[model samples]
Target chain A: MIVAAAKPWEEIMASLHGMHKVLVVGCGGCVAVCLAGGEKEAGIMASTLRMQRKLQGEPVETEEITLTRQCDPEYVRELGKKLEGVDGILSLACGVGVQVIAEHYPNIWVAPALNTKFAGATLEHGSWEERCGLCGDCVLGQTGGICPIIRCAKSLLNGPCGGSQDGKCEVKPNECAWNLIYERMGRLGRLNQLLEVAEAKDWSQGRDGGPRRVVREDVKLDD
Target chain B: MSNRDFAPKIVAFCCYYCAYSAADLAGSLRLQYPPTVRLIEQPCSGKIDIRLLLQAFEAGADGVYVAGCLEGDCHFLQGNIRAKKRVNAAKKILDKIGVGGERLEMFNLSGSMGPRFAAIATEMTERILRLGPSPLSTADKGEEGKAE
Candidate 1:
């Protein structure tokens, strides 16, 4: 899931400056599971905005709503009725959700409440760690299910860059991804796979190819 | 209200297993404590979340505190511990929102500690009195809200 954190209070406040009424939108998808932007968070944001603005003597009114998933058109369009008198939208969704709302509305002012961090997995109840780089490549099978592109600080294709100390990455406090991969491969009796030299990844398959879109002809709906 | 006559509105979220019972004991003993504290009983301190804590302040609470079982004595094991972390998180938000983190606190005590509960009430009341009213509270009271 994509993990994100709320932006600073001042920045969020500045974005909605001069707006008397605003709609705060939360996504019930990845941001919800990550505990960043969800129904509860939307309430907190709305309450804080109302209280803080009132305290500041601006007194902006806010309404909170959490869409099923802000990334999809179906859920984004559901917000139309609620936008009647809203001066702006404070989106608590990820970057994709914020863009979807902006692209759909066109004329409404939209601002992101969260700084989209990374494609990550929950390490524990409140801890999240980046796990996928979204490199548009499949090498997890060869690397023993850990994507070195993200887990490794250097994104080394072949093996550890030799800066690893006590299984921890030299560049960061996290465990060396190559070290984890080596151990995982060893435990699976597939250590022999590490002997082959890996070639450089295809840059065109990733962000270098520009914005990505997937169209499934089989699931196409006649418009 | 004038500075000298300021009475802080303190909200205490007391866990049933410990703090709530302790408050009850204090009442039975007729111990003297500030009447400013408004108690809300909870199943466990862990039941308290950031939203609830912030809402208390948003609702004009000058100060708020969470009272739970003494560290390891929580009826549900780590409820008090979880509450402690949440209180800290809320404190950070409070500080960020210019309300001052000193306005919120977390206390750990067993159900047998009636005197201790009274002491905490006095201590919290004194602390809030020293800090004056919450900026949010002052806003509600129609004063120019300013956090000291």
Candidate 2:
């Protein structure tokens, strides 16, 4: 799931400069599971803002709401009338939610309450490890279940990079994804897959293409 | 409140398996620790997230600490280790926010270490006393948040 971290109270305060009233929107999607921007988190953010503003002698009134998924237009659109008088809107969703809300409500001043971290998993409670780089062209089939694109320090495809020592990545204590791949392949008698000489990844599918979109014509409505 | 009048509110999140038992033992032995230290029990210290830690500070806690099972003895296998990393991460944020990263801490101890629990309580209380009150608390009561 996409993980996120809350912005500092000071930075949040700075964004609300003249806004005396605001709405804090939360997403019940990936961020909610990651414990970043959920209904509970939204409430906490509103409370923190009030506390900080009170400290600065500029207490602001805040309203809170958590949508099923802020990325969808329906949930956010349902909140139209609620934003009527809010001086601003603070989105506790991932970057996507903030952008979606901003795009839908061009006139409303919107600020992000959380920093979207990465496409990762909760290693343990409170510990999230990045697993996928979202490189568009997935190579999980050829490289065991692990994606070397993000797990490998350098995202090496052919073999373990020199930085990998005793199965650990030089960047962190994590095991080299390639080494883990090799070991898993060895056990599965699929070691031959490693010798397939992979081709250079197509860069067009990645961030180089700028904003990406997938049009599912099969599911689209006839407008 | 002024530094002279600040007593410093410290909150401790203790793992039920270890730190909680240690606290129980401390009381059993009648160990004398600072009264400023407040203990909140958690199933595992791993449950303490950055938000929870920040909330404590936001709610007037001058200092906050997480006490978990010693290193490799976590009841949930790796909960304490995860808690340690979270504490470290939160500390960096504390440092960046000018809260004096020293205000947040993480400690590891077994259920048998009653003296250690007492020691930690005293140590955290002293550290917080020196740091005075949290900037938010000070600002709410005094002139401005000072931001430190």
Candidate 3:
């Protein structure tokens, strides 16, 4: 899932200056679970903006809406009827969801409220750490379950570089990904798999190459 | 007469099973506490959203306090825990927006703490008196120097 954080307030204020009727749209997928741009966050942002606008004497009208998944066109289509009279949309979804909104509603101005960070998971409450790079490869079979592509500073495939110290990554004080994988594999009596090296990741599937697409003819919209 | 004219408006959200019972106990005991504290009974502390807390401030509450069950003794198991998180988050937001986070508080007490509830009400009312009035109220007073 894509991880993101809200943009700074100054930038948000700048984007919403002339807009009177604004819709703050929230995505209920990854961003919601991570507590970055969920329904609750959307409500908070809308309330804050309304208060700030009132203080500025502009008195903007703000409405909040949350979708099941913003990345899907089917979910976004439900917003068409509610888009009437809305000057613009402030999307709390990831970059993909924002672009999908823009592509779907070309007439309305859509702005992103979150800066998409990475594919990650919540380490604990209010704390999230990057886990996978989606580098078009899966090397977890040989390296236990940890992905060095994101956890390691250098994205090393063979083993930890000279940067590991005391079973921790030298770049950070956190536990070394390789060390964790090695220990897990050792415990499982699969230490011999460590001898096998992972190949270089193919870069085509990630965001850099182009927009990725998946098609399912059986689940067509008309059907 | 001027000294006796001050009346601080307080909003108390009492969770069921504990704090609500405590308030009931206070009433049953005929405890002499200020009537300024308006009780808003809720089914569980978890149901008290952050918006309601902010709304209390917006509605001219001099102080707001959430009374919930003891930390691990929530009737819904973790309702008080969720309420505590929201209270902490609301406090941070209040502080950042120059609202003085001291105006908001969260207290945990069992159903038997009628005296404790009375003490909290008195303590909160006194604290707000020392702080004088909310900055929002001061803004209404047209005092520019003390607006913050």
Candidate 4:
């Protein structure tokens, strides 16, 4: 899942300076699980914005709505009926969610409330680390299920790079990703897979050149 | 009422498992505490989101305190930890908006601490009294009534 954090309040306030009625939309998927721009976060942002507007003597009316999944067109379309009177929308989802909302309702102006970071998982309560680079390849089978593409500072393919020292990445003081993969494979009795050489990652399926899309005729709207 | 005669309205969010039971014990014991504090029982400290805490202040609460189970002893394992993070975050926002971070606090206690609960009630009331009435409360009393 994608990891994101809310942008600074000052920047958000600046974007909606003259807006009177605004709808703060929250996504209940990955962002919700990560505690970023979920329902609770959207409510907080709405209240804070209302308070800030009141302090400035500007009468701003803010409402909140949390969708099941903002990235899906079906979920975003559910907001069409509620968008009747709202002047604008403040999306508290990832970049994909924000774009989907904009694409679905072109008439309503949409703004993102979070800075989409990367695809990752929580290490603990308040900490998260990047886990996948989405390089259009999966080398976890060779690297022992741990992703060195993201965890390693240098995306080493076969084994630890020269920068690795004492089972730690020299670039940072953190434990080497390859070392974790090696240990995991050793435990699983799959250490022999690490001996095979790997090739450079193909960048076509990733977001390097342009956007990517997926379509299925069986699940088409008309069908 | 004049500024000097202001009565600070405080909202105390007590978790059901600990603080709420402690309040109940205090009542049964006839413990003397400030009437200025209004208690709202919540399922767990984690359920008390930051928005609710700020909403209490926005609804004209001079001070807000979240009473939760002690650290490492939350009934839900880590609910108290989440509550602490929310309180700290709300405090930062309050400070940023000139409301003074001291207006919001998080207290930890067990279900049997009736005396401790009363002490916190008195302490929060006195602290708010010293801080005077919240600016929002002075500007608009009817607004808070609408929220309720």
Candidate 5:
């Protein structure tokens, strides 16, 4: 799931400076699952914004809404009816959700209240860690299910690099991903595979392809 | 913001298992405490979210508190601990935004602590009396800072 953190309160307040009426939209998607921009959190943000505006002697009128999935056009369209008197929109969703809303309503000012962090998993309550780098390819079959592209500091295919010390990464005190991979592979009696010659990953499958899009013709309806 | 007879309004979110019973015990014991406090009962202190505290101040509460079971004594295991963490987190924002973080607090006690409950009420009332009304409240002097 995509994890996000709210932008600094000062930054949000500054962006909403002169706005009179704004709608705070929360997404019941990845963000809500990650506890960043759920309906409850969006209400908290709206209330904080209202108080800040009031403190400045310019109270803002904020309405809160939570859509099923802001990334989907069907749910983003729900804001059409809500945009009537709204001067701006403060979205508490992931970047994709925020962008979708902004693209749908080109006339209204749309601002993201969250800094979308990464493709990650909830490690525990109130904590999440980046798990997938979204390299447009999967190599978990070879890496013992650990993502070297994201977990390893250097993204090294054949790692446990020179900086690995006592099973810890040199970049931080965290356990080295390569070490964990080695242990898991060792347990599976597949450690020999880690020494196999590896080819450079296809960069085009990633950002180098310049904003790639998927055409799932099977799922699309004819226009 | 200072007045000789200014009585600050305090909104206390009391957990039913502990703080609520503690308040009730205080009453049974004929304790004398300030009447400025308004207690709202909750199943667990963990249910007291940040918005509830902020709304209390928004609604003219001079001070807000979450009275939960003593640490490790919450009805829902870690509810009191969670509430304490949330209160601390909200306090930072309140302090940053000039609402005076000291106005908001989290108190922990057991159901049998009747005297402690009354003492906390008096302590909170006196502290609030010193701090005066919340600036966010829309009372006469705070009307200039109205939200609507």
Candidate 6:
């Protein structure tokens, strides 16, 4: 899931300085699952903004709404009816969700309330770590299911690089991904497979090429 | 309002297993305490969240405090501990928004501590009195130096 964190209060306030009425939108997608830009967080942000403004003697108004998934056009469309009298929008979704709303409403001012972090998973309650680099390639079949592209500090395909010490990554406090892969492969009696040197990864499949998109004629609906 | 005439509104969230019972005991004993505090009973101090604490201030509370069971004596094992962390989080937020974190606090005491309960009420009232009304409260009265 995509994990995100709320931006500083001062930053958010500064962006909406001239707005009298604002609509705070929450996404019920990856951000909701990670506990960042969910409905409850959106409500809290709106309340905090109003209270801060009231204290400042300006007294701004704020309304809260949570979309099923802000990344989807159908849910983003739901925001159209609520935009009446709203001078600004504070989207509590990930970057993708924010862009979708901005793309839909070209006239309304849109601001993001979160800093999209990474494709990650919750390691524990209130703790998240990046798990996928989104390199646009899969190598888990050869690496014992451990994603070296993200888990390893360096995206080394064949590794246990010199920085690996005592099964820990010297660059981080985490257990070295290469070490874990080595152990798992050994247990599977597939250690012999590691003898082959891997070729360089294809950079074109990733962001190295411009923005990427997918098209599936089978799933497309006639306009 | 003048300092002497100002009556700060203090909200106290009391856990039923401890602080609430202590307040009840204080009432039965006819102990004297400030009238500034308004009590709201909760199933456990753990039920308290950052939103509730902030809402109290947003509703014009001059000061707010959470009274939970003594450390290691919570009825639900860790409710008081959780409440303590939340209080700290809310305090940081209050400070950030210029509301003064000193306006909010958390205390731990057993259900048998009636005198202690009265002491806390007196302490919180005095502290709030020294701090004066919250910026939100002052803003409501349309006073100057609102919340710069």
Which 10-residue window in model 5 chain B sums to the lowest lDDT?
Answer: B139-148
lDDT by residue (tens digit), candidate 4, B1-148:
5646877788999999999999999999999999989999999998888889999988889999999999988999999999999899999887766677899999999999999999999999989888888766654654555568
Docking class of 5: medium
**Model 2 misplaced stretches (Cα beyond 4 Å):** A1-15, A28-64, A81-85, A92-95, A112-223, B1-4, B143-148
From the highest TM-score down, the ranking of the candidates is 5, 6, 1, 4, 3, 2
DockQ of 2: 0.18
lDDT of 3 by residue, A1-223 (tens): 7889989876887887799999999999999988878899898778767655644546578888999989999999988988889999999999989999999999999988999999998888888889888776676666788888888888888888887888999888888888888889899999888887666677676669676777899886784
Best by TM-score: 5
Give lDDT tens digits, candidate 5, residues A1-223. Answer: 9999999988888887799999999999999999899998998898888877777667789999999999999999999999988999999999999899989999999989999999999889889999999998888988989989999999988777899999999998888999999999999999899889679987778877578898998998998
Model 1 clashing residue pairs (backbone): none
When sorted by lDDT, best at the front, the candidate numbers are 1, 6, 5, 4, 2, 3
Tens digit per residue, CA lDDT, model 2, A106-219: 998999988898999988977998999999899999998889999888888898988889999999898999999999999999999999998898868998767999999999
User: Could you tell me how far off, in angstroms, the CA of residue B11 lies in candidate 3 after the best superposition?
Assistant: 2.0
Better of 4 and 5 by lDDT: 5
Worst 10 residues of 6 chain A by lDDT: A202-211
TM-score of chain A of each: 0.98, 0.97, 0.93, 0.93, 0.98, 0.97
Could you give candidate 1's per-residue lDDT for residues A1-223 as a string of tens digits?
9999999999999999999999999999999999999999998888888877877777887888999999999999999999989999999999999999999999999999999999999989989999899988778988999999999999998999889998999998999999999999999999999998898888677887679878899899989
For each candidate, the DockQ is 0.53, 0.18, 0.20, 0.42, 0.53, 0.49
Give the C-alpha miss distance for residue A212 in model 4, angstroms: 1.6
Model 3 C-alpha lDDT versus the unseen true structure? 0.84
After superposition, candidate 6 runs with Cα above 4 Å error: B143-148
Candidate 5 Cα errors over 4 Å, as ranges: B138-148
lDDT (10s digit) by residue, model 6, range A166-214? 9999998999999999999999999998888889988777887788998
